[model samples]
Target: MATLAPQAPWAMRLVTDRRPIGPPSYAAVTLDASTQRARYTDTAGQVVKMGEHGTNQTNPTTSMSGGGDGAEPQPQTADDSTPDYSSD
Candidate 1:
């Protein structure tokens, strides 16, 4: 998912087609500076034409503050060979 701009008349966010079917039709895409990854969208009104694209856009400061990716964090593993001295 991507946001049009951090702040602007259209600060709308969008979910991109990660796996586009055929050749890309020059769908307006933007690169999120914070993530260093490009964000796109197949939904209309979200994407724009070339040259009409915006720049210097970034993710909202609180984009992920509400909650993480919604995935639980993985637990750290212990050294199988090491004994549990703490129990003693």
Candidate 2:
């Protein structure tokens, strides 16, 4: 149940050569367990699917709630520091 995020602007993608390469990447890309899918989109709008979120006893879920890890998502608020462009 580890979430990997880009501290700088880089994301490593293992290419055919089996080497990790990335720079000037994303701010954050979370590997969510809700849908049991691992996917991420970078600053260049490239969607990458690594793998699926496997099942584990540490993160049990009810059948009714789907395959979520039973952890509630934290609420996120809009960044008021940024300027609004509704007029535009």
Question: Residue 83: error of model 1 in Å?
Answer: 37
Q: Which segments of model 1 are wrong by more than 4 Å?
A: 1-26, 43-88
Clash totals for all candidate models: 0, 1
- Per-prediction TM-score, please? 0.21, 0.20
- Of candidate 1, the 10-residue stretch with the lowest lDDT total is 79-88
The positional error of residue 76 in candidate 1, measured at the CA in angstroms, is 39
Compared to the true structure, candidate 2 yields what TM-score?
Answer: 0.20
- Model 2, span 1-88: residue lDDT tens: 9998756434434334566777734544766689875557776657765555564333233233223345775444433343323321
lDDT, candidate 1, 1-88, per-residue tens: 8866555344344545688589665555778799996666454736444444334443322212233355876544432342222211
Judging by lDDT against the true structure, name the best candidate. 2
lDDT of 2: 0.51
